[model samples]
Target chain A: DVKVTQSSRYLVKRTGEKVFLECVQDMDHENMFWYRQDPGLGLRLIYFSYDVKMKEKGDIPEGYSVSREKKERFSLILESASTNQTSMYLCASSYRREDYYGYTFGSGTRLTVV
Target chain B: AQSVTQPDIHITVSEGASLELRCNYSYGATPYLFWYVQSPGQGLQLLLKYFSGDTLVQGIKGFEAEFKRSQSSFNLRKPSVHWSDAAEYFCAVGSSASKIIFGSGTRLSIRP
Candidate 1:
């Protein structure tokens, strides 16, 4: 079974603090993604990594950065956490394929920026 | 760029009633489609997917979806609704490895 693990289930941080959301996958998938889910906006992509040390910006990547130093791990970094960044963050991983087989997502981390 | 649209933001159904959630996608070519359900405070789970061949696909937890090429839609349906089926459903379209889009999502509410 494929398991994606997110380090934190819930987090509270003060404004302007640096926040790190970590994710790890056991499936050895080549693609990993970070997304933030909001009520009306839905799940918007923050960043994605196709391979180790390679990263791509998603639709909403301005306030976030990502690191994939290892294949099994992907970390999302908030340079300066703000109250607007408070939301449920999700991590997903999938095999590189022409046909989408869907992603294995981790239990999201609900971050509260005060 | 690929995009998805879920028309309904929320739906309410009584237990044992039939339910359907609408989803539409816009892509240049034949696209990969998927339906995912996320329980409150949990991760999203794959409900179903459509690649090719059969337009109708069955998934976990008694959920199924149909791919309509002409309509550019992939709607999820269930014959009967259960209380545990209450969750947020998202429809997604994948055009390429880097070009996948998810709909805003439809929140389902079940009443007894």
Candidate 2:
């Protein structure tokens, strides 16, 4: 079975602190994505990378950034964590331009900024 | 822009009862549709997907979804429900081959 592993399932950070959430996929997929899910709002995309060192901002990329240094690893970064940045973060991966095939998702990181 | 709507916020059914979850999408052309299930504290799992071909698509775990072009709907159904079937279901639409839009999700509850 394909696996997408997230580095942390729960995290608490102080305001203004830099935070990182890591994701790794074993499927050798070329598309990686970061999304923040909230009650009533569902999941909103933050950022996505289609290839190594390539990134694109999604609808809600204001407070987040992403890094795809290697093919398997994609990282989401919070420049300075704030209370509003706290949410369940999900990472997903898929084949290049193959959204129809769907994405394999990680267990998700629930981040809380105090 | 592509969007998905899951009108039912929550639904309850008795075990062994029939079940249906409604999903609607808005797009100019036929879009990629998907249904995913997420158990409490677990990651999302793909239940099924519809790309093309037959409007009726069967999926894992005895779940099926029928695509209605006229209605712009892709509704999931199962002949019988199980206690273990309680989970949150999300309907998603993909306008392009790169990005997907997800609905708010419907939480399913099963009773004995």
> For this target, which candidate reaches the highest TM-score against the unseen true structure?
2
| DockQ scores of the candidates | 0.68, 0.68
Interface RMSD of each: 1.7, 1.6
> Could you give the CAPRI-style class of model 1?
medium
State which docking tier applies to candidate 2: medium
Give per-residue lDDT, candidate 1, residue B112. Answer: 94
For candidate 1, lDDT tens digit of each residue in B1-112? 6889999999999999999999989998999898999999999998988888999999999999999999999999999999999999999988764556789999999999
Instruction: Give the range of the ten consecutive residues with the poorest summed lDDT in model 1 chain B.
Output: B93-102
Regions of candidate 1 where Cα sits further than 4 Å from its true position: A97-99
Pairs that collide in candidate 2 are: none
Please list the residue runs of candidate 2 whose C-alpha ends up more than 4 Å from where it truly belongs after superposition. none
TM-score of each predicted structure versus truth: 0.97, 0.98
How big is the positional error of residue B32 in model 1, measured in Å on the Cα after superposition? 0.6
What is the per-candidate TM-score for chain B? 0.96, 0.97
* Alpha-carbon deviation at B68 in model 2, angstroms: 0.2
